[model samples]
Target: MERKQTAELTNLVMVYDDNGNVLVEEKVGSNYRGLIFPGGHVEPGEAFVDSAIREIQEETGLNIKNVKLCGVKNWVEFDGSRYIVFLYKTNKFSGELTSSDEGRVFWMPLEKLRKAENKLWHMDQMLELSCGNTYSELYFNRNDSAIKPILK
Candidate 1:
């Protein structure tokens, strides 16, 4: 059997404050639009945590540190290649918040985000993973598109 290789790698980070607010991006791009965490694709040969820190800085103007790996989201593409997203969370960050071309960056209460209607597709599940409620998310694209969460 041929080995299934990962075709893409990405990262998502949930930056939170002590007052129960989490950093969010109101994405303006063509893909993954709506309210989401600050994150992006991992550059070639970059370390996973390094990629997360870099992406957060690029997207939200925050220099994050002490990032903790909370979970992951993965799926098989149509061509049988795999795509993966490493989910990370941290409260340690510095710098003034600013928005990039990707979206507007702001802090929102966790409960408010939970009830928000403008979240990206399957963002709740991703939130779950980032909040340490789950450890893995598997997207199945059979006849019906379904996301299954694997608890930690």
Candidate 2:
């Protein structure tokens, strides 16, 4: 018999600077690699926005404000576990970028992220969804490689 679907919460933040460059991290995790935004799991009982802020600070050493919930993404693992991600974007931040064992953080042009050499996961879709005006959600069936937008 198939196992029941279990839900898990996570977060992803797109930090942009005054120069229009977005902060990308080279992930050290085995499951994911290459250039990606700086974010991670929300701590237990923490407010979603607070979690975003905390993850941003921990991963990038930046205190960010104007934390906007721009989008959401759902990834259904092969084991029937669901990972829900809250996507945030912010231009208002302070402090120097610091390195973390999670990844090396740096600023890069949006176009550079789109280039062929970059190994970001779903870079085009992710960029579009995060920059979208309205809040959105996307579901990806990791087992089958199927994806579609979802309603809240």
Candidate 3:
């Protein structure tokens, strides 16, 4: 079958706790099967920021607020279409985590997630970009086997 590629806009939130643990979800029934932060597409006419909050609430049942826009990640899929994801992070939120149709949700230590087996696609790079209290954009070229930065 031919791979279908298209331009897409998405969001990914990195929710953290007072103890420094981060919430991650294990995605199911897709090519991207692994631990990933909760996030989804921005509906047409919906604000990007609003989409982030709504996605977290729907996927994790957490009423998140006061989230800071960390950065943006841009990549070209193997089939050549571009995919861009706006990243947000927040330690300020409430409500118990709930399971969603997307996957199982839970908290995991940051270090543990850094381990080889648990790492999601481009996660380490995303975390590094979030280290500073500033906003920026990251560009990458991605395929089934690798995700490399587009430096230039």
Q: Quick one: best lDDT, which candidate?
A: 1
| TM per prediction | 0.91, 0.86, 0.82
Put down candidate 1 lDDT per residue, 1-152, tens digits, no spaces.
96757579998899999999999999876555689888999899999999999999999889999999887787777777777888899999999899998889999999999999999857888887777554556465533567777755
The collision pairs in model 1 are: none
Candidate 3, residue 35: lDDT: 84
What order do candidates take by lDDT, descending? Answer: 1, 3, 2
lDDT (tens digit, per residue) of candidate 2 on 1-152: 96666788888899997776999888866666788898888778899999989998998899999999878888878887888888889999999899788899999987788774666666566777887653387778887787776544
TM-score (C-alpha) between model 2 and the true structure: 0.86
lDDT score for candidate 2 against the true structure: 0.83
Clashing pairs in 3: none
lDDT per prediction?
Answer: 0.86, 0.83, 0.83
Clashes of each: 0, 0, 0
Candidate 3 whole-model C-alpha lDDT, 0 to 1: 0.83
Ranking by TM-score: 1, 2, 3
